[model samples]
Target: MFLNNDLGPTLEKIFNDSDSLKSLSIALGNASIQNAQIIMGTVEISNISDLHQFVQCTVNFTSLTVELDDGAWVCVGPCQKNPNFCNQQGACQNEINGPHCKCHSSYFEKYYGAQCELYSRGAGFYAVLFGCLVAFALLIIVSAVMIVVFYRAKRTSSKKFELFEDDFFDFTSRGGYGHQNFSVTEDSINTTATEVTDEQR
Candidate 1:
């Protein structure tokens, strides 16, 4: 049957005797007293042994209406006899939720269990930036090497330049000087012949 603070005195009477609270679920709400609340839920007793056996109870005293860690109302289960049990001071911490228990502040939850861990955000950005810089430097170095190789290849494959003196002078002078000399000689001869003929006549 669901039990609230209204039936508090009666529930205590049940707890006074050694009784097992099995298959029992409870919820507490802050009312009347600041930071204090009442639990309400039903207890199912299967056999006579259950009535005498004590089932664990969870109590929550939280200012936050909704818990950020578990997305449930914050509550603490009863102190467990197991040394590994989570609620040491009858206080439930955020990490373990309700099912498991956590150790000290240094510990974090893993799939298998909780272990000491170090928190670091430095590795992420540094790795990416370092990789980019290395790649860029390699690209620049390869490009420079390729450019040098191409320059050397082009210089080696080019045809040689040759200059001949005769060819250069012929191009600059246009006509041959020997042909002009021959024309001058012919003119002189013709003039002499005309002069001799006139004298003879």
Candidate 2:
């Protein structure tokens, strides 16, 4: 049973053989399955900094007292109280030594501390970094392939154009089409002239 603020003598205790209850007095500051059996069966003395040895919720077997203040009892592990002692995003866990904070996600963002507050890097971060590097490498390779293909295609086209120019030569060059034989010989010209003179005579 957790006795909180009203650590007073207002309640009576009765023991019977027919129906009996036995209790042990021990100090625990954090919540646990074993401690949380009753009202989150954890007790804490909330004051620390001022060197104030006691708080309002102090209790003993014969009496109870409450001197309420800001530093009143709030349960933590045997030595702590504030659950957010483990940063806001972490869950406070009771360990044998003291309270520990477990991070919500270890893969994406690493958290480490007594309260799980400090971090360096996580596995997910490294994965993303690696993925980005691979993508960049692939992009460079593809660009290089495209450039090589374009250059080869351009070079091949230029060679084909040079061959076509050589085959055409030029209309006015030494091998022009007009230089080939396409008219009659001198013997035919003389025969025609003689026949004309005979007709005239």
Candidates in order, TM-scores: namely: 0.27, 0.47
The C-alpha lDDT values of all candidates are 0.46, 0.58
lDDT of 2 by residue, 1-201 (tens): 124444422222222221222332222333221222223334454545333344443323222323334755433242234646767767866654555677666777877776677877778889999999999999999999999999999999998888778447655566565346568989999999999999999
- Structural RMSD, model 1: 16.6
Candidate 1: minimum summed lDDT over ten consecutive residues — where? Answer: 19-28
Give candidate 1 misplaced runs (Cα > 4 Å).
1-120, 159-201
What does candidate 1's lDDT look like per residue over 33-61, in tens digits? Answer: 22223355664544433432343225343
Lowest-sum lDDT 10-residue window in model 2: 9-18
Write out the backbone clash pairs for model 2: 7-64, 29-76, 30-76, 30-77, 56-67, 76-80
